[model samples]
Target: MFSLLSSTFGISRPLILKPQTWRIFSSTHVNHALPMDPERRKKLDERNERRRFRIAHDPEYQAKQDEDKKQRRLRYASDPQYREKLLEFGHIWNTRKSQDPEYVEACNASIRARQRSFDKLRVRLQAENPRYRLRKSLHQWCLKHDWVRETLPWKTHQPVLFASKVHKECKGCTRVKVREGVKLWWRKIGDRDESWLCHACHMPMDNHTAAMPYGYEDVTTMEGIINRKQELERTAKG
Candidate 1:
């Protein structure tokens, strides 16, 4: 009888015999009803974390994903029969799964984990990548300058149009044509603002006039980026 009971629930024979153990293992307990294997669950969580991280951070992956979603949305909007079928399937699946408290708990846990992972990754990237920080600054500057719209169907200008508007009379020298306008310098604080400045003052051809002691260089390229990152790190130490 002991062996039979032990084999039935995979618990030790002694535990099965104990009244206290039985109470602890009662069906009323949510955890006792369904328990995930620790090792398997960890592997699944790691896999999901990696997938979510890539989707949230990778630009190439995001572009492909955006295109796929755009196509799916177009199809869903155009094909009534297909859309209906999808709606029916989604409704049924949601209705069935909504009744499962375990499934709901698992989904909530996964969402929370994904969000935590995303936040950490974003913070790390912001700390490590100068390019990302530069872009974010530009985005904020654009918003501040009213160069872009607030809501969807944004009035953001194309590169050429944006350049035209951004390149007008230098904020420093007030010379629009006689002097070449320079955009934000990745390395200099004065040049990083939204307003344009004359190249002579903000971005010198020889880098002698640059506020920062370092010479002006394009850090946008991969090799240049690594070199620039090291330079910044070295500068920070001093």
Candidate 2:
């Protein structure tokens, strides 16, 4: 009868016979099954809450937000019309993306292409105007003058000849002449009979007093007069 009972509960016989077996089993499983202490859990929750509060209230985060706001304000202030249009387009795009992304992209592309065409036309018009070229040349000249003042001088003044109708005058007789184009001349400066004749007028005057300075032969051109005036203005400024 004992053998039959032992066979029926073979593996669990020692556990039922020994009272200390329950204590050993309980000790091994207690650590795995027990819940965390309430106070420690509460302290951890408080710490996490404090961390989140600190992050939300940090001055650096606030400063970053303020800087972003300021940049947005400046951008909008500088280009209110563009900003308004962009914002309106953004809203439309967001609202319609699911329904009409392709249409929105096509509309934006067409507007950009039209704007580029208008810009190109404006550039071409400015380029065709000679006055615009002159102004640009004058501006570049001024910029170069600003770089090296000791060696290079700025020419800010317009020539009196440009304003006056007459560009040529006889130094000897004080006779002014208004000609359609540039005129050269030889003039006797004083009673000593010191005379200098420009190449253009010297061709007609056989008795022209003296041959001009070496490069003066080439100085009879319109470009020469402009260059001479520019040089004089630069010298005066320096």
Candidate 3:
């Protein structure tokens, strides 16, 4: 084996194994290691890039699009099973797509394009959505909400979603259980009850700008944190 390698490289096996020797001659010897035509590679890369650009820009191919549409229309119009299959496929596709950034950005852009002028009445009408009422920062919402105070007390360590017949599991991220020690959010001596969040989600929540209303300067530091806690306690008492 050693003699064959030495004969092939015209160098000692030790020299061939040496990293420095490989680095020194890598530019010349790399083709032997991974032989491929540079021009061919360049052409392939260009072709792939063009394909990606076309896919991103064009929703459907111009040549086959009409025929494809015709087939789909005929299938839907003629076959109930085809229509049902399409509906099921679309539901699943949209379910996945809702989480996609590109889809979300496109939806946002389309909504903004058709956005009506925000009058007071329009604002009030939009605000009628129950979601807006619960849009407060986690801390503020947890602190003020009676639902958390009385029902879901801060001292409760294992904060879990109610397991009814339909839902037999926690609604948290279904990722692998990396650690047994999930971040059990509690109302600390100076805090209100926050929901039990996984370590990954909890970290981002704590560090995020949206989490802190007045800014981290008020509650980030030890001294500031203490002051804020005392203020919260006072408010609770008052």
Candidate 4:
């Protein structure tokens, strides 16, 4: 009967008649069946503390940790969702830091330094390149001659003519010029050929000091132009 009872209760020991022995065996079996032991838990805690201490005290370990962190950040940044989260976090961090006057002044100082560096570089480049000086002189001449300013259309109060739209930079002349608000000035190369020139450079060749605007007194028609040219020739001869 005792053997039958032990088998039924799943007791590992041989039949013992004492109740105290049965209790001791059952308690010991329960302790052994537990998932974690006290000694194992203590050993795990110690290992984790040592790792933390090494990460703090050892330069090599700290560098490894930083590299690992950088790699993780790069990986996360490649993900669009994580990138948005990182941007939001950075904006919030910067916004909080911007409240400090020292931080604001430091940022302004750095910006001023960068601006000064850029200015020095530009001056150095301009001094090194003769073409830059020539271009600057040409630009100044254009401005001085009023070649790059707005003009009213002949006999009309419509929208002002923008010089940049009507004329281009004339490389042949010391100054740019406009003609009848037109961009091209063509000269006869032969009986059947013509060559295009900018109005500014063409003015001297055509014996004109200034460009004639469109709709100027009877110069609008072919006959008017011929008569005007004849009158100018007669005046020049006289």
Candidate 5:
């Protein structure tokens, strides 16, 4: 009858009694089969408990997990491509407002106000101190030189101011060399006048002797230096 039923249903007879099914049938037929080893089961349960405890109590693992989440959040927030895409979307959304005249005017006005305030402060500071004024003048001279170079391509001859004294072993030998000379003439460049050195440093082989005025004392303190510099500036101006 089973063979007839299998042939009618087109089913393989061997598949109906597969190995797993046969094992179940045999176990059912034989009662009181040996149960799983209690020791092995207990060992498996202990291993699972240890795994759970390790996951719950490991401080380093918890810290690493937290660090990963923090880095992920930072990457998402600071990704340039993501920000650019967002900006592109915003541009599309505010196509008309992007070109609005009122917004541009407001931005320009804020910038101009900031520039004016900065200029006023700069002027006041330069007027308050001689050193500040000298520095401002030097900066203006450099800017004017740059502007002149830009406007006149062939004007390669530039008037450079140099210091009068040269140092032999000083760290600023190059600077001293560049600054050697006296200010024969003064001219305003941008915001201040340029000054030239009154004397030039003698070359190492040259017979030039260091000249110090009789009874001259060296200034050491910052205040003394400032006073001396002011006196020098006054003399130069005269």
Candidate 6:
């Protein structure tokens, strides 16, 4: 790897062969010579429990931990190498955990319980909050459209409709599609403007078109609007 980097970046071999570089590299290859004695393991567990208690009860320590976590997340996002390494480690860890059926079952049960609680809370919020009700209704209306539904990808983690592919942001509201489904409309043929329109922005235009608000001699329906959008998308792609 060093030789490849040297060849690619034109770094001198002597620089990589320095004593300081060797010392740093060797330091990372520490051997676990100490055996896990029962007493030592018990002491370590007690120390970890104390640390956890301190983190939970101490405001200063908690704040420091939160800051440290934020910094780690920022670094993970900005540093591709670090992100890749972390992902690789996580994949390996998950793979090992998944090999145990009992562990997998426990994880699945916990996830299901959390999802049920979240769903109940969401339903209650929708019933109580007028704003939430309107937002959720608008979002549901958008999902009834074929084009918008197709854009969402399936996920193994969450079992919900339109639960995946949240990267697209709506042009009108700047909200992601995953929060509420979005409609990507192509205004005309041969023009490819990836303008994402969330339900809140799309509904008014849809209503206006259906109402023939401009007094034009044209009739429009929800199906007609969806069909037109799909046709325009195909034309733009072609």
Local distance difference test scores for all models: 0.44, 0.40, 0.40, 0.43, 0.38, 0.44
Total clashing pairs in model 4? 0
Instruction: Compose the digit string of candidate 2's lDDT tens values, residues 1-238.
Output: 2222222222111222223222211111111101134464455456546645765799785576568767766775698785666445434433443245564454456558778999999999988965454444433332343322222222221111122233445333333232332333334434365443322333323422122222323343335535765776787799
Query: Estimated TM-score per prediction?
Result: 0.28, 0.25, 0.26, 0.31, 0.28, 0.30
Model 5, runs deviating above 4 Å: 1-85, 93-95, 134-238
**Residue 3's lDDT in candidate 1:** 24
Clashing pairs in 2: none
User: Model 2 — TM-score against the truth?
Assistant: 0.25
Backbone N/Cα/C clashes per model: 0, 0, 0, 0, 11, 0
Worst 10 residues of 2 by lDDT: 25-34
**Weakest ten-residue segment in model 5 by summed lDDT:** 25-34
lDDT of 6 by residue, 50-142 (tens): 767988899998898778777877896799997666555444444554466764555466558778999999888768964444445435534
Tens-digit lDDT string for candidate 4 (42-151): 55446546766888899998798778767756776588776555445444444454465664555466558778999999999987764444334433433443432233
List where candidate 2 sits over 4 angstroms from the true fold: 1-94, 97-99, 146-238
Q: Which sequence of candidate numbers ranks them by lDDT, best first?
A: 6, 1, 4, 3, 2, 5
User: What is the Cα-based TM-score of model 6?
Assistant: 0.30
Spell out the clash pairs found in candidate 3: none
Residue 97 lDDT (model 3): 42
In lDDT terms, how accurate is model 5?
0.38
Q: Is candidate 1 or candidate 2 better by TM-score?
A: 1
